[model samples]
Target: MTFTAMVAQPPPMPDDPGGRGEDFGKSSPVGLLVLLVFLVAVVFLARSMTKHLRRVPASFDPPAGKHEAPEKEVAPVEKPEEQKNGAS
Candidate 1:
């Protein structure tokens, strides 16, 4: 009356017409068609991406060692002189 003895017994065979279940060992035509369609779509997408990428420039940065205007130095402001008490 243990669990092992109960599961150890084999299941009764089914009286199917073909004497076997559906065989999945071989590829079907529909599966091959789906794979072919996926490959074609990927090729088209890659070609489109390449065409768009070619229009972009290699770099958008400004040229090195070039200045539009010369730089100027700023002078420090002078302070007012302190007046003595009531002095002219």
Candidate 2:
């Protein structure tokens, strides 16, 4: 006996009452211009701050009577050659 298989089909899309024309009129051009102005002001302020920081000089010495020497680090003790040869 031979059997025939049925092909599957996608469901039809729903109709939109308010289409693409209804969405186009809702955009605000003035709000977009204000956002652009604010972005430009922020970029200008950031560039000014970077220039000010670059012009400043670094202090070489600490405040008087507060100067202290940094601590010296102790290295780990290495094994002698005589001990290595004896183990082998």
Candidate 3:
């Protein structure tokens, strides 16, 4: 009787197949530029938003006693004599 051990092994990595492995898992220059552009845009947007937020009034309610000119004082108009008498 004889006993044998069978072991499974993972495939080996290629040193450089068709120059594909050299730059594998590496970021490209274009990718870095795009990321930088996005970061810049985010910074500008944040600055703009902060400025606008600061300009906003703390409370939407107008300041006390600062509303429209005191409502004009208008005399009530008199009704027509016929309408007052009563129309049919």
Candidate 4:
């Protein structure tokens, strides 16, 4: 058979029943409620994390006490003088 004869025409599309059936992509109430719950949880967690983070210190050192003495610096050791040419 010729290519043109072998090719069959597609069936006609159904008539457009515009605005007849329920909308295809409408968001249900349950889905909206779930989304709202998720958003609220995110906001609550963010606020809570911010509150906790504000109490954290940048450095790990403990705060100094009023009665605590300051640390002392160590002095370097002096090297003994070398004896010249086997002289004791």
Worst 10 residues of 2 by lDDT: 13-22
Q: Between prediction 2 and prediction 4, which has the larger lDDT?
A: 2
lDDT of 1 by residue, 6-80 (tens): 456657657873635556367799999999999999999999999999999999776687655568998975544
Candidate 1 runs further than 4 Å off: 1-22, 64-88
Worst lDDT run of 10 residues, candidate 4, spans: 77-86
Highest TM-score: give the candidate number.
Answer: 3
Residue 67 lDDT (model 3): 84
On a 0 to 100 scale, what is the lDDT of residue 35 in model 2? 92
- Model 2, 31-80: lDDT tens digits are 89999999999999999999999988787677788788778999977679
Error of 1 at 36 (Å): 0.9
lDDT of 4 by residue, 1-88 (tens): 6555466796664687565445657879999999999999999999999999999999876576645667999997554554443366
Give the higher-TM-score candidate: 1 or 2: 1
Q: Which scores higher on lDDT, 1 or 3?
A: 3
What does the lDDT read for residue 36 in candidate 2?
97
Write down the lDDT that model 1 would get. Answer: 0.77
- Write the candidate numbers in order of decreasing lDDT: 3, 2, 4, 1
In TM-score terms, candidate 2 sits at 0.37
